[model samples]
Target: MSEQTDTAAVPTPEAEPTSTPAPAPEATEAADVATEVAEVAGAPEAPEAPEAVTEAEAVTEAVTGAVTEPNVWAAPPAPPKDRRGLFAALRWTAAVAVFAAVGTGVAYGITQPERTDIPGLSTKDDGRWTFPVLSRPALPAGAPVPQGPDNKDGTHYAPLTGLLLPAPEGAKADDAVKADKDGVVSADAFLEEYTPEAREKLKQSLEWDGLRQIAGRGWTTADGTRTHVYLLRFHSSGFVDAFKGCDTNARFTGVSALDLDDVWSKAKNTQMNSTTLDFPGAANFDGTDLSVYQEVKPFLGEEQTKIGCLRTGDVLGMVIQTRKGEVAPVTFHQSVILQSQLLS
Candidate 1:
């Protein structure tokens, strides 16, 4: 039996275990490629949740309500008034008022007539010559009728005393009896008393065509000052203008006699200086021609001498005043003022 068993064991080869037939090389490589593909193509991820807000941010949003944009369609706010602009408007108003006032005054001045009476030398319009404080001299009782039939030419051959201005306070008529009679004289006769040069000059000056007559008076003051007044009448207003032209052109200063040798020298001394004379009134008095002159003569001790001539309508008037050692109580302007009043 032992022998038979040994023989059997030797004869039965040990059965090889069947290891999953050593996998094929190609199949193993295919499985490895499938695993790599799966790793490259990862699975799709899930969506993330939103972040939470803080408590402070939530409280601020609740307190200030939601902000909104301004409305572009609404009207804008009105602009503030400018204080400087208001002041400028007020200034413009005041300037307009001033201009209006000035315009009114200018219009008034242009429309109004020129005044006749001056302030200081006011005259009365009571058909006679009168002043504010001084009364006019009364006509001598039953004085000879003016320009009587005997003087048919109306040449003023009769006495002109009634027409002459009254004497100053301290002065009296030079010739009380013959003053009125001697006042009237012919131009030719009057020129005869002057030097030849003076006579010739006066002759040419007095050649005012249509001259009717001339009357004049002379007075000597206590201080050796001399005053002369003359009145001239012309036939027509044209003649008066011509006479004034000649009188204004003639120089009557500095020359001892009416000589034209040094006309330029004499002209320099005849300029009209400032005085109280109402020249504007005199010039406008019913269309008058007026002029004033200065005369200086050392021989007569006269430093201040003045003469004024005026022509109004058909009448001309002249006044001459001379001052010697002292200032004359009456001024040439006063004489002219009174004389002009009488003439007016």
Candidate 2:
């Protein structure tokens, strides 16, 4: 009995895995290992790369997806159970940071002042004015600035009278302008350089007429030739006078005040024969009391500027004018200027 039991345990050719038409031993070994691997209890799942989304888009998409989908839908898609979903949040945060940085740079550049090559801030220079600009003229350039004399030569020559005072900016000029278009100067420069008293005195000056008798309607230097002076005086009712003498309705943007002064201001050098007989106040071509200014006024053009000053009592209706610089007296409205002197 013992021998028979031993044979049963030891024999049966040790049937190796009951190999059905068994392959080589090595192949059998490989099959066994493969079967073991397949039977592993659990293997980790591969991590997936997160899809990037911007904050704004993610919010919009989330809202849209929520709103468009029925609340009744399958439990709201299980709330992305992946803990790594925090990666989506990080991606959204990075996208927002990039946009904010770009927007900040543009705003800073726009609010700054442009760089200037000028010494003090920015000063513009455009020189092509035969007359004054919208701005006033700069300081007068000549011998002794702000000279107390009206004459270029600087003397009592013709008592400074009826000369236009530099008008305060915005002060109307016979309804046409504040002043004859003057040069370009700053408001500070104007006030500092020009004084009211100087202007008042300038208003007192007389143009062209000197300390001599302007005789025979035309004055003659020792040379026999006489000057047939055509003087015209204009009255200021309003815009009409600024037209010089053309059309009463004509308009003139300002002509040049100083340049005109240049044209009319004469040297106080010439001397004449007579300083007697109250220089005829206002005269007509006929020289007969001549109350009518219309007869001899053909020479006065519309849009031309008239010169005069604030009047004193004795010089009613009298004004001075110069059509050309440093030339002879063009016109002096004696009556009006003299009348102005009667300012009540």
Best by lDDT: 1
- The C-alpha RMSD in Å for every predicted model, in order, reads 32.1, 25.1
Note the residue pairs that clash in candidate 1.
none
Across residues 30-136, which tens digit of lDDT does each residue of candidate 2 receive? 44444443434234432221223333544576667743422221222222334356578878899999988887876665446543443356535221112112221
Model 2 poorest ten-residue lDDT run = 286-295
Tell me the TM-score of each prediction against the true structure. 0.41, 0.17
User: Can you tell me which runs of candidate 2 are displaced by over 4 Å?
Assistant: 1-77, 115-344
- For this target, which candidate reaches the highest TM-score against the unseen true structure? 1
Estimate every model's Cα lDDT from 0 to 1. 0.51, 0.28
Clashes of each: 0, 52
Candidate 1: what lDDT? 0.51
Writing each residue's lDDT as its tens digit, candidate 1 over 8-107 gives 4446687998654454343344444444444444533322211232335434655685424222112333333465786799899999999999999987
